[model samples]
Target chain A: MRIYIYRRFERFWHWMQALLVMLLMLTGFEVHGSYTFFGYENAVHYHQIFAIAYLILVVFAIFWHLVTGEWRQYLPTLQNIRAQLDYYLFGIFRNAPHPTRKTALSKLNPLQRIVYFGFKVLVIPVMGLSGILYLFYRYPQQYETLPFGFVGIKSIAYWHTAGAFVLVAFLIAHLYLITTGTTIFSNLKAMITGYEEVTDHHPTSDSQKQEEVVI
Target chain B: MKRIFLGLLLLGIFAAILIPSLFKEPYRPPLLSQLREKYHKKASKSADHSKFLPLQKPFTRPQEVTEACISCHNQRHIEVMKSSHWNWERLEYVTGKGIRAIGKKNILNNFCIGIASNEAACNKCHIGFGFKDASFDFQNPLNVDCLSCHDLSNTYLKASGGAGMPDPSVNLNIVAQSVGRPTRNNCGTCHFFGGGGNNVKHGDLEMALFDTEREIDVHMGTDGVDLSCVDCHTAKNHQMLGKVYSLSSMNRDRVQCEQCHTDKPHQQTILNRHGIKVACQTCHIPTYAKVNPTKMEWDWSTAGNLKNGEPYEEKDSLGMVAYTSLKGTFTWARNVKPEYLWFNGTATHVLLGEPINPTQVVKINELFGSYRDPEAKIIPVKIHRAVQPYDKKYNYLVQPKTYSVTKGDSGFWNDFDWQKAIQAGMQHLGLPYSGDYGFVKTEMTWPINHMVAPKSQALSCVECHSRENSRLAALTDFYLPARDRNYWIDHIGKGLIIFTIIAVILHTLLRIYHSTKNQARRDV
Candidate 1:
């Protein structure tokens, strides 16, 4: 049965963030001299512009998540986590029934919660901060009249590029995991249309009860 | 709910960065005008020197103007006469041996060789009258040319081969009437034209300084601070501060930027800590000769190339004189990166009689500094390289008479006779010449203190500390990251990170394996 899971704002934020992140990675890797698609200078300009837009998106999305209490979707829990791990590693290949149920609440089962939380709290902030510092490192107003030393731009570039690699790694894992849903297109369609097909009808957890009120 | 707090935190950070910047004041150089006014009291409440009776007369010789200047300002000529400008020399205090009188008049340089037999052409920059030969009087107070330094009209033209006088065509009366405080043009007439042309001797200085954009030179730029020469080289009693690298060390006259800007110019402590070991110019002036090309290499051995027995010249891609039959092959470059060196405010000059190693390329003057020295700072210097004649037997660099272009004489440029020119130059200095001379490579290092670019245009960190193509690649005295990396440390650091990541992944895999087995057991 089709159930309303992802909200309108949640789907919108996801798609927008996807587009911005992809654009950023494209121009960013070009700037990092991975392979030139756009020229380096143009890549840097586009990357900087996309970075600002991504930051604004983050601001609005954070507020939206708080107002609607959709942020609880990523709060990790031990319940059924071992069963979910067992399903991914062994039970899934043996054609066993899935151990965890996907409902309106608890969208990310345990592993996704930890990875997404770390990305949002740690990796993304590092990328944003290092990128912004590189943009204004030799800012005229800051250093022209009074030249002073800080951590050098070389170190900053190194950190920003490192953070980009982490994001790329996360993206690769995320793309592969999207196919591990009930069907290959199920997870992607749910993200796009704010609806998912589920077998269960009864609400089980307190989070499920809370999500029922919102729906 | 937690996301609202996170949103507020990010907003606060953005506000913290933007709000203070709106009210921050621009930098203002510390003013010493009030202190200077108290110490060196001005002669008048706007007293005009043009109305003075002695200056009102029609002047013929520059000496006549000097006579009028000293009549009222009696102590001025005496102070100038005692100065190195008028004397052309000073007692060497930094010498390892006992104090000896050394000056530009006695020095032998690779450019236009020396002042001995070529005094007529060279005396155009001299601050005295009739320095045409060794016998020229130095005791005459009236011979001091005041108009060269104090000329407000900017019409005073010191012609080559004019014996320390302004070219005769200039109306001396108007020059005398127009006396005022010296400007950059007044000082740069000789300085900018040193080594015969603009941007020749000192690569950092050029005619571009007269009207520059802020990008080329922030301090002297028209749109910027627009500072004159004397602003930094402050003169007290006509004795200006700063000693040229080619000249003897004038330690007392060295001007530090801290005199105007405080010791801690920056708000950040990281920069203030570096101020002790780094010069203001080291970071400020990333490159030299930004506006026009400066001579980088001069090969006098290739000189005397003639097109049908007549000297010819050729221009390069940048339109700089690439090949001159009279002066030889010259390589000029603009936006040239300077070599870094440790300088502890002292330099050891190679005087006229000093012995040199004829087998090796000699440093005409060596700046004395090292990492070990507590007072030393890494400074930027333009190392002017040239191939000039050296006395092989005597093991000394020769001062060839290069500019004396008489019809049948010993000038090197006129006849290309190295023996005659070297002999004449040595004889004038009262030193014995071996008559055997060979072309030897020589270098003179001039500290780059001008043409400060805006900080945005200043060199990025990688330009100095990168693995390849770094400006300071040749600086082996210190350790820098990427430029000088410890292999073991790098490997260990990377190895630790990689090992930790692999261990975490292995631990996660093992946990998943154990958990799956337990789940299967429960189901069975």
Candidate 2:
């Protein structure tokens, strides 16, 4: 049976962020002198534009998550996380049952919760702060008055580039994980239509018991 | 959820519409035109120089004109005597070498070498009555030739070999009566023709700057603001506000563009930030030697060649002096792009009697700066290279007597004898010169600060930002984006990306194979 899981704002935020991040990477790598697609000046110009768009999307996403109490979906938990890892590594090939189930209230499995929480708390903040510093490092009026001194742009640029690589690797893995659901295109369609096909288990089953424990 | 999505959609729409307008180019004020208007009124002089009775008197000797000028302006002679123009040296605190008097008199250059024993010929540009030898008195105020820079009639010409005296053909009375503030013509007479010819020493400075279109130079162009040399090089107590690094070793007395155009002149903050590390001339002066060809290379080893025991000269296809027995073989070029270097307005010169490595190309004067120096900026320069004589045994540069008044003398220009010329030149300076002599390659750098092109012709960002033939490719001290990248990071980062993609493909294929097997078993 299909049930509505992703809200309208959640799907919108997800797709918008994906598009913006892809554009940032395309222009950012060109700016780094890695094979040029857009010219250097145009790349810098567009990179700044997309970066602002991404920041805006992030702000809206943060507000929506907090106001709707949807932030609890990503709270890290160690329960069944090892089973989820084993399921992806070997159990998926044997058609074994999933360690965790998806629902309207608890959308993220234990492993997904930990990964998303770490990304939100660590990676995004680093990329955002470093990107802002890179944009305004040469702003003359603010340069002298800044509390912290920067000898050069070398360290900031390296950190931003490293974060970009991490984001790209995460994207590759995320894209592959979407296909590991009940069907090849089930999760993709669920994100788009907000309806995921979940198995109807008995109310007092072990999975339900585990879901109660998680909640 | 639907209401929140709609709100975000509206916000995104507003941002998309408003962002472009926020970045629209702002109106930039015409600061340059306003500056021109302010300085344009100073052209009209208050006093009519021709009405002075002292200047009207017929002056026979150039010294008599100086005496006539000193009669009215009595204390002005003291300021003139103290200047580098009359003294030809200044007390400069050179780094690593305590206070030393350095100037054109002591400094050696690749072109025309030094003026040790050849003062009679080289002193043609000196603002003095008689600097024929080492015995020329520096204490005498009468010897200061005031008319060389003050003559407005353009008739006060210096004799070619008369030791800085006025030419006999010049009507000194007319020149003295017409004396006014120094114009481009006055400064160009000596500065534009430093190495015995127009634009020979300084590629960016030449006779073309006396009167040119705005395209050649925005400031000195007669059609434009028409600023005189003194407008920027403002003088106080007869000491000018600028010094060439060829003779100067200190960073003081600099004439900066920021004096008028503020450091943050650009409307865009991005462009203004470049001013910190890039000099104005680096972009404005795209090319030097715009109108006339400048000497690029001189080979003294080929100077002794003559046709039938008579000194002769050869001309290149462009009619430039290619070879002259009196001087040397020279290579000339026009519209040449300047090479860039980091400079902090300070330099170290290869002094006289200083030992040099004969095997390597020695820098006559080394410009001191680096990417790490906060005060340093990238500047455009014209490098004049030459192969000149040096003492082989002593491992030091030896001055040669290239010119002499007496015919068939031991000077290099007359008798063409290297041994005798070296001996005479060394004896004049009281420096020991080994009899053994050989030619050594040397380089002299002159900063190109003039012949500034219009704003439209300034260098674009791609010139230095691209990986292909970047202008700043030689300066590898710091990392510049688009032109530089860390090799290890790039390799490792790319490797991980490729590895992730391969693993994803392998895992997906394995899952697909297992699923097909399970589906077949369920159907059976």
Candidate 3:
């Protein structure tokens, strides 16, 4: 069986999207007065425009994911979840065996499915909502008979800020996990070049049980 | 292909440059009023004493003028002679005792401190004559002499050292009227500061000028009705009002409310008949400005507010707002007075309403002056800060002991659940939390109020409750400064540090979870 899970456009979009996101985070923090890099005013201006670009890219990415059936990859499943856990925790460390193998037909292991599923479903939406709120917070006129006492710009501001911290954490973890691929640079290279070198033959249980190192 | 590549490269550069500058904020320093600038720079030069006294060689005052002043003010001849004014040509006071910068012959006044730190307040009055800019002898050249007040007809000056003049108070008030009158503006020069407190400016002089005639802003007010300059400035102290930059002879004690008005008897009789016990000033005229006349009222006729075919409880038979004995939004006008007014407090974002312990994550930019957003509204734009890490609010106890679960009768806090109680406590502190709002499975609310309850440890009264009991001190992450902007800024900076810890912790937890999984795999 064979499958082309990610189209060329999908891979190109993903790599570029990731690069832009990292750039945005760096500049967004500086503009938020976390530190000075490109000077305060410059940082702030860049953050605003970059945020717009991010929003535009997100729209395109969402459309692409929907039209090309790529969004299905993120739909989560719990099949053999325990085996996947065991594979990571115990199996891989001993170089014993991979309980679930990667294939063109099924790219992710169970654990990868669950984690990436969560990233798409929960983390991305939360950050996106907060960021959009932060940007468009100016519109609502903010007036009433007694100036709505219980709510304020503060609560909204805190939400956006808290959201920013979560995004920063996600980026850090994502960067670290990227290095855990076949080679230190393999995942990064695949993202850039749209091609990954997979083991030519599928490793069979009989071969692995006999301690064979199948090329 | 090469040309196409070059075109794309140029386009990329153009896009990068255009994106940031398009959203940039323009740089303009804070606006300083012309008068304020003049008050700082050529302050004494514009105070032409030559107009009061002619430019002449040192000559004694007109004999009759001295006799004229002596007629009523018979006491201080010897005191005047011994004063630095008497030794005007002598090398004393200027470099010796007055101006702190020189330390000698600088006997400007009773001010013991310099202008920079505000140890004393003579800088408000009796400032240096032609200070350093004139390149004259600061030690003993010019004196704000006794003659500057008493010599009414003739004036004298010694370009280098001395000058003499005599004047009457009324004439000076008249002449000084044109060249910056000694009115509320001059009073603000000193009284706006508490002379020597930590918070520098007293009144919010930075407040934008108000032109509206009426607003029922019951919580604030300034000048109106009988509450005029006389209400506060009831008396004049030193008969001689000092030079423009110098301190005035303001009789502070005489300015108290009791100093002038005899307690009115008619107010009590009316109150007795009505069975009400309250000060007439309390309800009738809420602020200083309302008590003073000539203050205009906003239009109530156009407001169209009426009740039962009448103009409501606001007016009496005379069509005046009964309580104020005038028309229009008298209540809001009263609130404008700085003395009687109070900030709604909530409007200022003073109350910490999110992340239960707002002090945990302070605004990093606020302390370092780093927070600003070019994309946001320009009304006092700033990088609104939350607290950061390394703060002392880790264990702050929050309140609001109950919360609603959802819209149904079942969700109300009628039943006592431990989860509800804990959630309530967190809510009071403005901590981060998620719960069911009506029609929604997941809704989050950050802290709206914070109260770190005192540890149950017994203590001396002064230990925990000493001076820490402000009306909302328990709820506040930052204290309102008694005197300094920097103090307030620093306090806010310190309070928001706790959140940085949360960020760091979250970051570490994720890394740890992944690392642990990776470690476990290798061990197998």
Candidate 4:
């Protein structure tokens, strides 16, 4: 059974992105005066700079995904989703079997593929655009021109604040599911050093599925 | 390898943000200071150009220059002081009229009629030694002396340690708020900007506050004469004072714009990129210049010029005449919009707005001493009064308004009760009076119904009844009533250290809590 469907680069990007996002969310809220860890102004400046870097990384990731054709793997499908949900809910707890197999080509669990794809294409982009708009959302001193009189300042501030709320919600969900990985640190270590082992009893790869004589 | 690279990238980022910033102190936070005591005092105190007030510091000025004009243009100073121009000085204000406060030093002199605090006000009518002084830093210096051209001699100090008269032949000053010069920089000293790299915020005064050819935010910038700021904003040494017999009650316009703009064309209705019809002054409204109008505060040195035994009439050698008339009349139009007029009584940071219509009127029953009220008048009574935040003079400002005071021998309350006074003032002004500012103050009503009433008046007992916008000076945010900033900074540092220790303890507790909770759940 194949053990490495997630490439070294993809795993590296995933965990690096996760850690940075956690740091960012923690610091970003502190900056907004929600709470304070670092001083408020310092947190704000750090959040802004890190946000800029994250945006640059997104650009790089998007280009990499496009070049690698890995983008196609996340195209949403209803196929096998119901069965996959049932396998995790009942079969896996009963020790019957995992309904899905990990392969060199398809590494993501069905739920993760759909959710991650949605986040990358929709949620993150909204956060990025709204945050960028917020940073420069000030009236030019020389021009002093504004689209909306005073409302312009307030509106952008609202949008950025709303986006931050959404991002924070996502972080809470992501952190709570750390136990879902094969072992406590297995998924985390795979992201860092780029490898994870699979037991023979579990169906490990689609190549093995293809080699099955009857199916 | 990737983690190593990530570490290097983080290091690079830290260096980018920290190193240069540390060296240059590039991270200067916005100055959180609002107008404080030193500034408030400066704004409240004004220079007496008309009277002989001692200069704050020694600089070159001629005492006798304008003496000749007193003979020819008698009473020019007195007349000028009564005008809207003198409004900066709060002349004729029952407490103070016409005058408003801007910065303590940078008094926004309303030189142009029909245009409040516009560029022409700065470069045209307002004149001083800086216009001729080569060393003046136009950006910061409150250089324009109110008396520059008004003096009969038309005298000015020259760079070469010489005092010379403006060419008497020249007719400086705008020709009565009419058609004049069109060339750019005409009012650029406060408006048109771009001279000497003197950037302007809005389209009010040009770059220079005084002669700032470069910029208002910067003082002492470098620029050449070919690009001289005065090219368009040409002021004539007209040797005259404010407009006579106008409600405005300030100096006649100075710095003739016609020399450059020979033609007069009003608004040709057209739309700009924003799809709004335009006028040259629409975006360039005079409000910018007028916002902090400081020119009107009375120079304490010239406060009460009493000529007790003499008659009210005085004549200058020029066959000019003057009177001690205290009648203040005003017209409401484009330039003379409703605004607060601070009196030279006491300097306070508080702002009190005027109503479009003043609810009362007062006549000069007498000047220079004991007088009687000829008739009953509505007065504004104080309801509630509070001291200014972080009083700069750091002295007690006892407001005997909302709170109480003992009356002499009269067991009954004082007849001039503050609560009654404000109610009466509010009633007269047709305003719903509430709030208990005690000291009673009122205003004589104006002629018209201004839409934005409370937004435009002087600080009165009745007006401050409502509270809004809780702001504090920057100093108050930190520990203060202490010595210099260093001690306060140390206090903040200690707070940070305590906070860090608490954070570590809290984090350890949280980790323990979560782990135990997880184990209990698993056991169950």
Q: In candidate 2 chain B, where is summed lDDT lowest over 10 consecutive residues?
A: B35-44
- Scored against the true structure, residue B272 in model 1 reaches a CA lDDT of 53
lDDT of candidate 2 at residue B174, scale 0 to 100:
90
Give the C-alpha miss distance for residue B172 in model 3, angstroms. 8.3
Superior by lDDT: candidate 1 or candidate 4:
1
Residue-wise C-alpha lDDT for candidate 4, range B86-122, written one tens digit per residue? 2333332222443644321222111111111112212
lDDT of each residue in A29-128, candidate 1, tens digit only: 6665455577654676677667776777787788777877878887767788788888877675555666777777667888778778888788888888
- Cα-lDDT of candidate 2: 0.85
Ranking by TM-score: 2, 1, 4, 3
Clashes of each: 0, 0, 93, 79
- All-Cα superposition RMSD per candidate: 9.1, 3.9, 28.2, 19.9
Question: What lDDT does the true structure give each of the candidates?
Answer: 0.75, 0.85, 0.35, 0.35
lDDT score, candidate 4: 0.35
For candidate 1, what is the TM-score? 0.66
Candidate 1's displacement at residue B271, Å, is 3.0
Please give, as one word, the docking class of candidate 3.
incorrect
DockQ of each: 0.04, 0.42, 0.04, 0.11
Give one digit per residue, the lDDT tens place, for model 3 in A115-194.
Answer: 77887777677667766655544322224222233334355445455555666556655665565455557666666665
For model 3, residues B151-240, the per-residue Cα lDDT tens digits are: 233222212211122222224332222232233333332233222221121112211112112131111122112111222333233322
Candidate 1 chain B, run of 10 with poorest lDDT: B36-45
